[model samples]
Target: MEPVLLALKFLVPLAYLATTAIYGRLFFAPEESRFARKATLGLAISLILHIALLLCLGYSLQRCPLGTIGEGLLFLAWILAVIHLLSEWLADTRRLGLFTLLPTTLCVVVGVFLLRPDFALPPQLQSSFLVFHIVASLASYACFSMASILAGLYLVLHAKLKHKNFDITFRKLPPLDKLDKLSANWSFLGSATMVVASVIGWVWVRKDGLAGMNFKELAIYLVLAVFLGAGISRRLFGWRGRRHAIAILIGFLLMLLTNMIGTHGFQN
Candidate 1:
């Protein structure tokens, strides 16, 4: 089972890479082309395989698969891919594939090749509440990641429009307004999830008598606050387009910074 799990871990990323190639064809193909359908189908299959791999890992370890940094990275990549597929289904947009899949593939590559998997599940994460909190937080991070990618695309389109560079790529991207709304929607979802995760984390910490107001916790809250502020500004001040995009980009940077400082269970 261990050997099978390891092989699946390697295979999952290759599947994702194949999906990326199929999606890349969408750049030249029509919106409703056969390639778009194939790409969507490929993503669905890849997601299923990824989930199965995680389940096998969990079963083999007799614990949650998210006990190690490498496992967490794989889980995060899975969440991103799932969320992207959901978004694609809801919006019927294939263009977001490249942006989303690029990071997804990178995450899988890093998880499989760069990070070492620790089979030991820490005592601190034995609680179900902590597990839920961590899962929710990772999901929120995935949402924020999608928002940042959309925001980046928004800025690129905005620049092209500003300079009147009506090239093929410019025409290929989603409309500025659509991208803005999508970014905002993802940000709102991420913020809401972050709030829930934070509350759960606080409660768990208090119940366990652990110090909850650490630097990493503070950083996570700060990032959540930025997302909330961005959403509020969008609603109250009617901030959109470039400014809103920049705010989301900044929030994503803060998220990366928080990850760099330390994640939940791994923090000092």
Candidate 2:
């Protein structure tokens, strides 16, 4: 059942990528403006399909789709897609979607392909808190990744502007200040989520099965601390621009590493 679900997950992402790629090209094309509208419709269709597939998986498994590396990452990708779409509407930017959503879909597909299908849930993961923790952490990671991209864009823009040359791509971006504010806000929100999740996780660990200091526990703490500390600095000293972007990238990388090490090594 797990393997079949794992295989089925691939279809949704493939559908997603196909649609988004079409959107990206259509959005950039000069010949026709209809492409953007068409592409957006495609994205909408793909999203609905993805959500339905996930619901089916959850219903069949009678679990919160957190059972394995593949399921978790794919769901994370779904979340990122949702967030990306919402942010696009809120921020009023179509160009950014091409960068953030496409890679996420690809990565989710790859994660689903590589991860084990029958990965059993441990005794400790039986609680609702575990779901909260996992969901919060992944959502935060997605935002931070977005922030990092914003930062990278800032770098490229700043460089071109510094050289006294106008780059078309840079001009399309929201004002420098707007992008900076968005990145900071994303990280700040992500950090808050992580902190809340971590606190709940502590309670879950205390009550369920985890009492000793496990490597995974330590990793979670380290990630929580990194984001919290960064958030504090941003709030106090007005952290923004390149420095903020670098910090977001660094923090997300730590979170990813901890996830990889814990899920793979500990499972054996």
> Against the true structure, candidate 1 has what lDDT?
0.85
TM-score of 2: 0.85
TM-score of each candidate?
0.94, 0.85
Separate clash counts for every candidate: 0, 0
- lDDT at residue 240 of model 1 (Cα atoms): 85
lDDT, candidate 1, 159-237, per-residue tens: 9999999986687898899999999999999999999998898888877766547788888889998989999998999
Best by TM-score: 1
Query: Residue 264, candidate 2: how far off, in angstroms?
Result: 10
What TM-score should be assigned to candidate 1?
Answer: 0.94
lDDT of 2 by residue, 1-268 (tens): 5555555676777777787787577545554366666666766777787777677677766788777776777777777777777877898656666777676777677765755534667755666876887887777777777776666667777777778766556556567777777777777777777777667766776676566567876886787677677767877887767676677777778877887776422221
Superposed Cα deviation of residue 27, candidate 1 (Å): 1.7
Give the C-alpha miss distance for residue 113 in model 1, angstroms: 2.8
**Model 2: runs farther than 4 Å from truth?**
1-10, 26-32, 115-117, 264-268
